[model samples]
Target: MASLLPYGDVDFSLRAMAGRAEGFGRNAIGGLHGPLYFVTTLADDGPGSLRAGCRRKEPLWIVFEVSGTIHLSSYLSVSSYKTIDGRGQSIKLTGKGLRLKECEHIIVCNLQFEGGRGHDVDGIQIKPNSRHIWIDRCSLRDYDDGLIDITRQSTDITVSRCYFAQHDKTMLIGADPSHIGDRCIRVTIHHCFFDGTRQRQPRLRFGKVHLYNNYTRNWGIYAVCASVESQIYSQCNIYEAGIKKKTFEFYTEKAADKAEQKSGTIISEGDMFLNGAQPCLQTQHTEGCNMFHPSEYYPIWTMEPPSHSFKDVLQICAGWQSVCRPAEISTNLD
Candidate 1:
């Protein structure tokens, strides 16, 4: 039931989308060969807002020609080669959200983050030492804390075709367990659509995540959460359960003086559970944890083998869409 998207037609090419940023952000290349900035109001800051073209510092690519909702009153600090490109206008960013500290090449696409209020608000907050990031097709929801919060030593990131709802904790990779430099986090979530959010659909401690073909459904308090020495590689995802069907949860932190580390080593390949879904995995690995394999980070990171047709292709191709794209595409980056 989601149609009607004719924002005056579009034609975006955007430098041929630079190889479509994949796992480990595939070298972001954000404001890809720079210069474009155009967000004509819905003010939250001066001069054509969007926080004055994401507090420009150099490369730009921000786009938007007005479509509605942009309430934020703070926390819009986005620096580093930017590219907030919200497809062909249909934007939405409610009160307080977005803050990628210590930035790097960034690329936040399509947009629509809902009501995010006071203290610790986050709809997108990559922190500490951000790196090449690529959050595409955004559409987060009611937030107070997390909708996306990559912590401390943030590393190469990539969240694709997004669309989460309601909200509870919903995403927090490596922050606690005394930071421990977050073991140089490296994320790569694919084709997202964690609808009924509740628990951190993303909850890692010392990161190295890489889930694929996501389409989680009806979660409440357990849908992928592993504390301490984190490392998840649940491939071909498609869990679907309502009354909490334990899709992995192991929180018992206490690292870096290491004594009480519970569990953190998820390696469920070709996943696909329905109705009473469950993968409650944790079959050992609490001894100096370290077990990752996304082909050991880049050897071919692109998959799709869990279908019921991605539950309607992740609710009609994830979020914030208005079809007909191309208000600007910045030509031929040489």
Candidate 2:
């Protein structure tokens, strides 16, 4: 077991044990208490750019900085009271971004994750028995599965201010459908953006998911789905940019098949701004405990001004040109 104290010292001996790859270096820096270990890749090479490291039982503070892409083909597990801060840096982890397996008191912040080519190359995979985890300000895109997945006994997890895009399946919280285990509980998602053009909207399987102030555009399906016994508090969510379908649909078969579930509610209190240029679909759901409330607004149409006639028309078009005509109109008319 690794010690969580002596926060500032870097143990060079642990480098070899942690499997430091080529082109990456590990150093210990003084932090709050014990030494804090920072693993960095100084090169911009191809595939194998990041150094691989793990903490099973000991406490650690790991930082990965990649100028280019990096791949972690295996699990990057962090134990209790550990902090994995990427410091608003970019990292392309070809496999799982950070796997919290049966751990507690873990915090992951300021990292970007790009998935691998496999089926389960998720940004973060939380296994059963993990608790009190906080994932904040991270960006996850282009994955086969969801960006962040919580399963088994995971509970009390919070995800905020993140951006998820180009995922076949976006955020998922609960046990795998095939596996029979305890459900995920007490999860919160706030102030995030989900651009799900590739797949359906973000989903929550089996937990209490609080979603507020999220922006979803160009989504293929419902912006939010709560299948199992989950309570979703949705407010100030701009769904579908008034282009695609507006209704929130539930897969009733999937919801009913889940063990002893309760249908959730959708609360829309604030402005549901819709650009009248696109058609809108009424919100829909299974007939039961589910509910939908939409704010009333006059659908506003944004009209594009007529094309410029000539220099005479151009003079009249100058003052309002900024907001009226297309940006290319100026150069074209000139």
Candidate 3:
């Protein structure tokens, strides 16, 4: 029928975008007070290059106008108050990856990461104490460790409008349960596409997470997981399971030393599942333990009514919105 004719794409595709007002990672602005800098060369490291500019350790807007695969020889260590905007071109990062350690207020958007391999490489690694980050409209595949890894007390992050495919260990919020420092990790993952990933659409630990409005197709093993004191709140997402009947939405794994212990918590609301996907809620912890609740962190968001069904919203708005491309906005910091 006419209803099936890429209706979702017509409404939500990148071609429909006009500006950045509806961008999902809209709040993640790093250094709007500074001047805008563009990546002029494909050189990974040089006097005036991405690697050199990021090491300046000052507040600035970084944009890329050229398109090429930059094979990083070392993990690009980003400084504080930097925004790497790849919106206007097709930039690909391969061979190596980016690292954010103890940084603040960074924004990464509209790029592609593939064919990366090296010592503990990831598409983007949010290291300890990193905060106020926004990653959106990116594509990632075949990373050595994870597509994205937020660990070591990283907080106030939002990952949105990204396409993740052809990978294993898609995302990880917390590295180890016993690393009590990870208790401070809090992230929001919204409107992303988990396509053909094997596992860990995000295996969590020792953090508070909120997942909303995502579209998942062809999950290899499982969809969402919570492990070791992690509190995950999933809302209004769509999941299409793979061939295995065990392609579930929620799962719990035994922590390293606590094999018999109940792991984390999963609280979901209004999620859609198809193709024999059924996930049982599992939060069998001991009595009187202080577990985090979803409502306390984020307010419930409502979608506009009629004309668009839940399936349509997932297909159209989940990965990338071309019509409303991401733009830099200034804050009231003056």
Candidate 4:
């Protein structure tokens, strides 16, 4: 029995009502008959901020419409059907962080999350039993673990068209292998870019993952690390100068076996150059993995901005752009 609060009609700024709403429940902000609780990120031209008081079973719709940045130092958890829409604006969540636990039909879109100099600060964390979650068109930077992490029975989740940079890990799905079978999770990652220059390569363990048309550049380690029993079906993916193509070199033996089961084309060279020199892998143990290189003759293509499948579903249009240098291009590794 969760209460419903529609923010589509309210007009309260998150900055103006920060202290007043701290510890305020649904009855205080929205009143008993209030249809919604509106929260904005603009506060006296300073850092627009909002802090949700401890809540038990309330459904909230929070909108981040601030001009500058917003820091959420405390935990804000909502019930089923709650929505947080950033409207493609720049709203940052810093400090303690946001927790969406046991929530269903949740939507978090078009925002930025910056975890401060704290440890274990995650941009958006989906706790166990949180189902039907949608995180789209968000940009996240500077976190301890990753921009977004889904674990513990979090099923039917969608993370699309997001950009992640300057984090220890980019994106993660499922907890440690010891926690397997405690959750049934399915994740779809599309059209996202991972820049792992600061950290080791990004890893995704456990669950069934569908990774399509993602671009990774300048990462220290591998692109993705799928678990032993995990089913990772990736297609039309591009990885540039990462440690390994799909698995870290340490897990080569296990990753090779998994790559054999889930088949697809992995383009290790730059997308701007896809010529006959490009290597395609049908299995994990195939030789000549390093002989091929991506060419700069391929055409440049742009997909719809917010759609993760835009690159995979859309067709290429114009000529290729020579962005990478020849010497840099020659050093393409899997």
Top candidate, metric lDDT: 1
lDDT of 1 by residue, 185-288 (tens): 99999878899998888999878999888888899988888777788888988989899888888877887767766557788889899998888674565444
**Model 3 clashing residue pairs (backbone):** 14-321, 14-322, 14-323, 16-323, 17-322, 17-323, 17-324, 18-323
Top-down TM-score ranking: 3, 2, 4, 1
Candidate 3 residue lDDT tens string, 179-280: 668878888777778888988888888788877677777777788877877777777677778784443343345455565545777776777777787766
The local lDDT score (0 to 100) that residue 202 gets in candidate 1 is: 91
Error of 1 at 281 (Å): 7.2
Question: Where's the lowest-lDDT run of ten residues in candidate 3?
Answer: 14-23
Clashes of each: 5, 12, 8, 4
> Which runs of model 2 end up more than 4 angstroms from their true locations?
1-34, 42-53, 64-66, 176-184, 197-201, 253-263, 271-334
Q: Each model's TM-score, in the order given? A: 0.35, 0.64, 0.82, 0.61
Query: Cα lDDT of model 3 overall?
Result: 0.70
Misplaced by over 4 Å in model 3 are 1-27, 247-260, 283-291, 300-334
lDDT of 2: 0.49
For model 2 the local lDDT of residue 229 reads: 47
Output the lDDT of residue 6, model 3.
19
After TM-score superposition, the amount by which residue 301's alpha carbon in candidate 1 deviates from its true location, in angstroms, is 32
Candidate 2: tens digits of C-alpha lDDT, residues 8-115: 121222211121110000111111122345556633233323233345345555555444465665656666656555553554555556677877766665567776
Q: Write the per-residue lDDT of candidate 4 for residues 1-334, one digit (tens) a residue.
A: 2211122122233212111111101112221211234455443222323444114246555554444555554555556655555553456666545676887766555566676445655677788787766665577788766567777777666565567777767666666655655235666665566655343233444455555556555565555654434445454555555443333221322223234432112333223212121233345523333321112211222222222333333212001111111111211111
